[model samples]
Target: MYSPIINISALEPLYLPHEMPTCHRIRAKKEGAPAEAVKGRRPTDVTIAQNLRPEVNIWREADYPGASDTTRELLHHWFGRDHSITTADGEVIPFRY
Candidate 1:
């Protein structure tokens, strides 16, 4: 699931501690896609496919300012049914636990 995060007060870098270090990637896309992510051993989703599109390369902007319901649904699922988030429009979103 992928959701757009607005009002990022700070996006600091997270480095591995001396005892624990891991590298990762931030995949941002351009084209719109359904908001669902696989939940088991094999994990992937439409975002991955859309992001892979030639035009949807890794960029620093959202595919759309306010992603469609599909995007929200997918993201909600991927993130877990138990979290809460706020939209840019001040809408409070509470996930199902």
Candidate 2:
């Protein structure tokens, strides 16, 4: 799966340790996309595509502050599915394991 880091806290800007030079390009068109999305990209920064659709996964309602209606739906879907996650302190937050 082509899983790009959707979590802002998960990485720092211009600090993608795994990306190969000029191997991938990113184009974001949603308000949910982090502002540093382009800045985090390397060697291929350009105008974003109009039809870009990135999958936003809101693990916790508190995590995503300014989610749109469509993004809220995704939150509802994932929350409904009872996905579980561990915090930095190693505590499980969700109901499922």
The lDDT leader among the candidates is 2
For candidate 2, the per-residue lDDT at 46 reads: 46
Off by over 4 Å in 2: 1-63, 82-97
* Model 1: lDDT of residue 14: 39
- Which ten residues in a row are the worst by lDDT in model 1? 16-25
In model 1, which runs have C-alpha deviations exceeding 4 angstroms? 1-65, 82-97
How do the residues 10-71 of candidate 2 rate in per-residue lDDT, one tens digit apiece?
A: 24435333232323335546655654334322442443432231222233536556778789
| Cα TM-score of candidate 2 | 0.20
Q: For every model shown, what is its TM-score relative to the native structure?
A: 0.18, 0.20
- Cα lDDT of model 1 by residue, 30-92, tens digit: 444322322322324867654564343222134334667797567556543466799999998
What is candidate 1's local distance difference test score? 0.45
User: Which 10-residue window in model 2 sums to the lowest lDDT?
Assistant: 49-58
